[model samples]
Target: MSQDYDKILKENIEALILPLADKLLGLSLGRLEEIPDDIQTTLERRPDFLKRVISSNSHESYILHLEFQVKDKAAMLNRMLLYYAMLKEKYGESIKQYVVFMGRRKPRMSTQLKEGMIDYRFSLVDIHQLDYRKLLDDATQPEQAVLAILSNFKKSEVDTILPEILRKLQALTNNERKLRRYVRQLEILSNLRDLQKETIKHTEAMPITYNIEDDIRYQQGIKYRKRQRRKYRGNY
Candidate 1:
């Protein structure tokens, strides 16, 4: 991934990718805790291109791989099948395979020939289909707010419908513990990335602006003041 694309990926990992992965792949906080160590390591140590993998509790499991494809390639299934084989070899047999499609548009699924045997078993999730409007109606209050904040990248266009989004977010934060965790994670990641980008820009234009002493003072004073407010608020 190019630097710009990588930045976007970093931004989306917590906001969009992780949430969607959890939703479609049946990953919850409790479920994730049950994954075996070897499988967990494989997921954690995926190559630069691959995003994640998930497995179920039953003996039968499917490996979910995330990729960003600009254009559909002919050998996509073949490549995924090969990855499945590699994973099986690393672990033992008795593992299924799936490749998640995360892109601007939906991808056309194609059949693959595996040594003259046919195999076409994978899943695709076009992020574009996660429309804010659809989620607003179908999703619970928490999910609705999550979808809205997750779509912060599309804020300008989405701002028109944000009254409901804000309502959902506020409601979710007050009620759902799990969703509150997700929202906090998303906020932390987004803020860190934004700060990183701003720091990089300032360093490139005026290097001396990268003043750690001043930053530490500001953090201690301003951030500490905000943290102290937690005592006054019941929900904080």
Candidate 2:
């Protein structure tokens, strides 16, 4: 169950990066570039999303490192410092780092490290603190609409927003295949905010189409079974 939840969380966060980078980073980005994910520290620690974005104003480019967290972890600040050191070593550019907490509870994680001669810090944001209406108002991007469910939406607004979000997602897609994928993503993200029932209720009325095989979780299950079969056959 934990694994399934983590998978959904990862997919939801990744899907929104393209559409919500500016909002997430609080900067108007000109051109967004994905950095290679294989960069590792000497100790073999891999960091999360590392991006190169050009500032909308000034036209200057910088590195944006983002780490998404569902719960507070011990020594997270140390980990971020390690990642920052490794990233600075490789890119040789100014790197701005941020940690986005997706959990419903208030974040208690440390965002800075202050000791003798070493002062390091990074920005921390909680998704629930953000205003949901901003995302709901963005009609051009379906990703924002989907993410708005996890934001600070009032309980009274759920009925109205959920249906509208589903309608917008369906209209954004051109074919049944794409529509299903979006719906599946919406379902997964809604679960994070404990609105799975509302999501199902709204999506059922829409003409969204999806295949079991097209879903990533289903595909992963198939791969896991294949690996298990291969191992059993070898033992036989």
Candidate 3:
């Protein structure tokens, strides 16, 4: 992933909801107890999504682990395997791991490792392959509704889908300030699909306003990203 998209990913990690986790990542979990994800024992990085969730089907407790992957980097499986081991040691519970790939290209990275005496694998899903409408259909809150931006939708449908998402956000969140944050999130995630312009146009049309000049993500972090063209692109 480029630096710009990576920044967007970091910004949205906390915002990405469990409804996305359950559907996109295929984990039927309930009553999640979020645990600290920053357990950097040997590696310098932390897991993107880590929580103790009760299995909705079995009614058992286990660790639900998920990661948002934008790039098919080398040694990706190695990193996940490492995470599995670290999380297993810490939590001592059965684990479920998944990687939600949101990059432009098809994912080429291997998801399993079958060594001489070991067999390990993790679930990998491409966000573009899922149905965007179904995501909104399952969404019960504004946070879940905003994630529809990352799911599969056509170029012509940008005007349609984005507006629906904004409307859902408006209906769910009676708070204007909260709606603006989801607008900012959609603006950032739309770049991964190369639909930033359309996202901003419809978002600007909404009743709530998203002030890019005041948003710290727009001013400080996304400043050097030249590919993400907008009205404020040249201002900073």
The candidate that wins on lDDT is 3
Candidate 2, residue 155: lDDT? 67
Which candidate order results from sorting by TM-score in descending order? 3, 2, 1
Most accurate candidate by TM-score: 3
* Estimated TM-score for each candidate: 0.43, 0.78, 0.80
- For every candidate in turn, the CA RMSD to the true structure comes to 13.4, 4.1, 5.3
- Candidate 3: pairs in clash: none
Measured with C-alpha atoms, the lDDT of residue 194 in candidate 2 is: 78
- Clashes (N, CA, C under 3 Å) per candidate: 0, 0, 0
Task: Please provide, for model 1 over 145-222, each residue's C-alpha lDDT reduced to its tens digit, 9 standing for 90 to 100.
Answer: 544433323534433444455455555555444433433333332232233333223223421223344342345577
What is the Å distance of residue 229 in model 1 from its true position? Answer: 51
lDDT, candidate 1, residue 46? 46
Task: Evaluate model 2: give its lDDT.
Answer: 0.74
Give lDDT tens digits, candidate 2, residues 56-151. Answer: 677688898887777777577988898888778888888989887877678898888999999999988888776676766664655566677778
Question: Which pairs of residues collide in candidate 1?
Answer: none
Which residue runs of candidate 2 sit more than 4 Å off their true CA positions?
Answer: 1-15, 41-45, 56-59, 210-236
Candidate 2 matches the true fold with a TM-score of 0.78
Error of 2 at 110 (Å): 0.7
